[model samples]
Target: MSRWRRLWSVPLLVLTLCVAGCAITVPSDPQGTLDRARGGELRAGASASGELVTVDGSDVGGSLAGIVEEFADSIDAKVVWTVGSEEDLVDGLEGGDLDLAIGGMTDATPWSQSVGVTRGYAGVPGARGPVVVLLPMGENAWQAAIEAYLDREVTR
Candidate 1:
């Protein structure tokens, strides 16, 4: 091949690889545990009080709580519900006292670097459920995964 052709090929290949690598991986059992509220208990913390309570009363575990419970049942993952303020939930998740946390689409930088937030709820501002991921303090892969999952779930 011509030198110019080879040079172009290299750039094209790199571009393709980058694009492919950007694709997020959706977990196999993304909705299974939340779809059914199964036996495997997923300790989830949430922040619901006052007006937010009446608005998202059933969403005490956060908006995703209901869906998580549904999937948990399907996969035998029982979700142990924990109610608390948003700050408390974030603290709990960071402290490892809770497996997962539920909260508004506020700042999720501290808890999990890989945080995902969705918009579009029935009576809320945006999405129904948003998810966030906690990266290794300086990475985005984990966040990508959670975003992909949340993207899929939010649309559903």
Candidate 2:
């Protein structure tokens, strides 16, 4: 093969390898959100809405709380629910006091820009807009898992 042909072939092979789904795995952090939540408690800070985060402490209804309960059960982790305002929930999640925060969060919520927030979900009744969840910033795995679960549960 000509020198130019060999050089071009090398680049092509490299591109092909990159495109072909090379199994690159970055080990999960032992202390990351998912790991921590699984190993310990799944702390959730939720603001009291009509029923989403009921102050009555009844598990009979509400979208956000129901989903959280399911998640806690799925992971076999205990849930410590803190019913408070949005600021309180966000602060808890940011301070690592909580793994997830749920309220009547909408797309216009200021927290969306600061930390990780879930997509708007229409899982609750009497909601003015779609609800979202506040998460620790850059917690990709945790966010993805939450999103997937919500999609599966809420859609059904």
- Kindly report which residue stretches of model 2 are placed more than 4 angstroms away from their true locations once superposed: 1-5, 9-13, 16-31, 57-61
Q: Model 1, range 37-75, lDDT digits (tens) per residue? A: 334566666655333232244445334456545545545
TM-score of 1: 0.45
Which model scores highest in lDDT? 2
User: After aligning candidate 1 to the native by TM-score, how far in Å is the CA of 6 from where it should be?
Assistant: 24
TM-score of each: 0.45, 0.79
Clashes of 1: 37
Q: Candidate 1: what lDDT?
A: 0.47
C-alpha displacement of 126 in model 1, angstroms? Answer: 7.1
Best candidate according to TM-score = 2
Model 2 — which ten-residue stretch has the worst lDDT?
Answer: 22-31
